[model samples]
Target: MNRITLVRRGFVALALVSLVSLALVACGDDDDDDGDSNGGDHSTGSATIGDIAIEGAYARESVTDVAAVYMTIKNSGAADTLLSVSADVGSEAQLHEVVDSSMRQMEGGIPIPENGEVTLKTGGLHVMILGIEGGLKAD
Candidate 1:
């Protein structure tokens, strides 16, 4: 074959290899998303532990073995609620509170009052994961 013909064949072969590689990479990305497609940002509906209804429960970055899981606990019944949280990874998990003292900035305030509600988010009282599995995303 002419030199020009040989060069054309080589270019075609390279393009085919590239296309296959791209396809393989795409398949791998899908494997990472099962019920966790949101990358831990969005939510997976309500998480019911016993009678308590945990609304808007979610975590970010599954790769992080220790994730700060946050949720809104809604007490629907007439009586007040006193509850605690537990994760298999952490040795001890406490129900924290964030308060703004007269001097210091807002931080882990006091323990949740009896039948009181608390929000664990950025710069607020959060679930202290004493230990973690891999990496915990504080964000």
Candidate 2:
């Protein structure tokens, strides 16, 4: 066989193997009914309190005993404040924000404008879950 033809065949074989591997990895446990596609305790859901609605809420896996939570807060009425946060899986939960490239506990809470929304995500604002027992998992 010509060298160019052999090279093409090898590339196709490699591509096929890569695709199969990806498919196998994508097939996760079906028992995860918490609507988290990434699996494990990283759950996703929505909730409403008074005039505010929290959407797309989810937690991240912990490296040690600390994890972070991300979500979007929408206000349907007057402006509101997210004073604090709590989780049963952790000893303490607090609102945190990044300021000038530094992370600190957010004092006075996060403000949500009237009829506006606030997204708490990485590198900005998020919820810190401290003293998480047994750590967190995403599998």
Q: After superposition, how far is residue 57 of candidate 2 from its true place, in Å?
A: 0.7
Which pairs of residues collide in model 2? none
TM-score of each: 0.45, 0.66
Off by over 4 Å in 1: 1-40, 49-51, 62-66, 101-118, 137-139
lDDT of model 2, residue 85: 61
In candidate 2, which residue ranges exceed 4 Å CA deviation? 1-43
lDDT of 1 by residue, 1-139 (tens): 0000001111211111111111111112212211111232243234343333445544444343333444555434333323444454446445444455211222332333334444545335444433555543323
Give residue 65's error in model 2 in angstroms: 0.1
lDDT of each: 0.34, 0.55
State which candidate has the highest TM-score: 2
